[model samples]
Target: MDFSLSDEQRAIQDMAAKFAEREIAPHVAAYDREERFPLEIYAKMGPLGLTGGVIPEKFGGTGMDHVTYALVIMELARHCPALAGAASWASGVAGVSVLRFGSEELKQKYLVPLAQGKVPAAIALTEPHTGSDVASMRTRVIRTDEGYILRGNKIWVSMIKSCGWMIAFGTLDPALGRKGVCAFVVEPQWPGVTTVPFKNKVGFRPMETGEVAFDDVHVPASHLIGQEGEGFRVAMCSVENGRLGVAARSCGMLRGCLEEALDYIPSRQTFGEPIGNRQLIQSKITDMVVWHETARLLTLKLASLKDQGHRARQEASMAKMYASDVLMRGAEHAMQIHGAYACSDDFAVGRFWRDAKFMQVIEGTNEIHRWLIAEFALGYRR
Candidate 1:
């Protein structure tokens, strides 16, 4: 299959790269240190229609294909992964749920404003009780004449501290496994909704992750996305698509680490000789390159499948798993090449190190992804 970018793809990538260089790379250092969400950066992205890249024209989006979206993600991620994280959160919260699944009214009410970047959005799925067992979520939504009352807590929802809406998933009936789960669009200012911001992450600090508590939060029936007993499927679908975005991001991080390590090794001195001249450093760099290409190759393969209207579950998992590992190991090598300088923000490698570790945790932990890959290969059907 041809992996070369079309003219349109190149244009989008150029635009994303320009935005990242001017808007993200300069301010990322201070933002990362402060652990703050970059609203100005999001505002710049909104004008590019970045917030609506994959939604249809009717849904107020550019309606671009998935591969183009993935390219934009990669270009932006290369400059600053935190900015990429914010864009990723906004894209999924606005496009996938409403443009793909929500009713007309839900799209108008939430997705429209979200696409314009007047407000941001996030997905709240993981709870204190639920990890990879999405069907076992303990959050409950009790029906009412008006709508539903939500009672549960979601953990590690990123960038919602300033978002205007949350696409939340919960169970109408827990005993029903996947079938009982349902999805809803809940506004941030809803009467019983409360959020406590989390700070001091090892990496990706600019994304602003946190906890969301739905203490008898009341939502209207009209806000239900798709229908009752359909939440789990929608959540899984959103996450599956979302993983492609993560793969794009991980590749960007891996490439950054690899480039940094390569650039440093040749210039670094060891015993009056270039350390990169040594065989050991060459071997480490070679290993990093291998993993990085593996990540990129898997990402492109899954992206091709997605464009062909095929399921890309296994491909996405493999890309995420390998790309994250590459980023982590490459970051380690980057730090080693720079020695103690990598520990400081003085070098980009330190931030990449922390951010790469954070990537390993988000999207789905490597542990979870491994289980999925193993299960698929073993022909285990759930």
Candidate 2:
């Protein structure tokens, strides 16, 4: 029942927390207002050795471990979930995939710069027609003389505007179902690649969601990750790791919302007395603490399983579901304590409310995750 973090994990968390307060807190609201990606920050993070924390040193990364990475993500997200979303998409999701599957040349070309924060990458699996049902994607890639010709549309691509490379998935042979899908690295400078910007998202505005269209975009066979027809496995692997990142982010959001509510309760006055002294406010704050702790515990459990090299598919789903649900609950309670002021931009609670609502929708919606968990609990699907 010991519940202490290792020295490395604690150091990573503390560094992330301090960096977020110093670098992220000041511009978060402005970034949300402008709906612009924080493009210049990575240049600064490169010299600070923050970008490549978990990547192996061979690939020009510090090569720590999963739990440390998850902890760092949580600490950063507590300050600016938007910035965290963008960076995690690159350094967390897409970055992890490259480390797992890329060829040595691919590693030298893409992974090194990515880990060093010199280049940004994106995972391009979700399309306009498919999200959680990723196996049904319609994008097609055909074998050519030297490589593959890519043609499809990927929508809701987080950080597309900022990414220099994309790890994209498409069906090479449709008859094999999910087995036919293959993934390849496509540079943004490649011919026939175009991007359409998204604006005014309900939350995570500075992350820069967009649609990427591949019109006869050609990539060399050397860019293929592992082998033909292996994209589905690669995608699933990245997502299993990604579930940990999402759970961590959601848990941090809950903690941030609770932190705000606790601080405001005592300092804010109602009925000529501090709100913290009132029993009603105290009850609301208590519920927030409960939700925050529940989410944090789930995050830690998932991280431990991942660190042990277990598959973690079911554990990841459970952690993502519970943590995201708790994030929503904490946001709701935080807003309730503020009354009317919660709806205003002047207070940070409003942003947390919107962000938490989106968390339930993103990273495989809670509905889909429940089905996944149920299949395992039932001893296999009926």
Off by over 4 Å in 1: 90-94
* Worst 10-residue lDDT window, candidate 1: 86-95
lDDT of 2 at 6: 85
Model 2 agreement with the true structure over 1-382: per-residue lDDT tens digits: 3458888778777887888888887877777789887767656665555677567788877666767777777887787776566446534667777778888888888988887778777778889978988878878989999999999999988767878898899997667789889989888778988887788888877767789999999989998887899888877777766788788888888888888887777668877989888888888788878877877777777777766777778888889999889889889989999888898887788888888887887779999999999998897942
Poorest 10 consecutive residues of model 2 by lDDT?
A: 83-92
RMSD after Cα superposition, model 2:
1.9
lDDT of 2 at 246: 85
- Candidate 2 collision pairs: none
TM-score of each: 0.95, 0.95
Residue 173: error of model 2 in Å? 3.6
Error of 1 at 301 (Å): 1.4
- Model 2: residues with Cα > 4 Å off, grouped in runs: none
lDDT of 1 by residue, 114-203 (tens): 766667787888898776777899899899889999999998887678888888888988899899988899987889888887878777
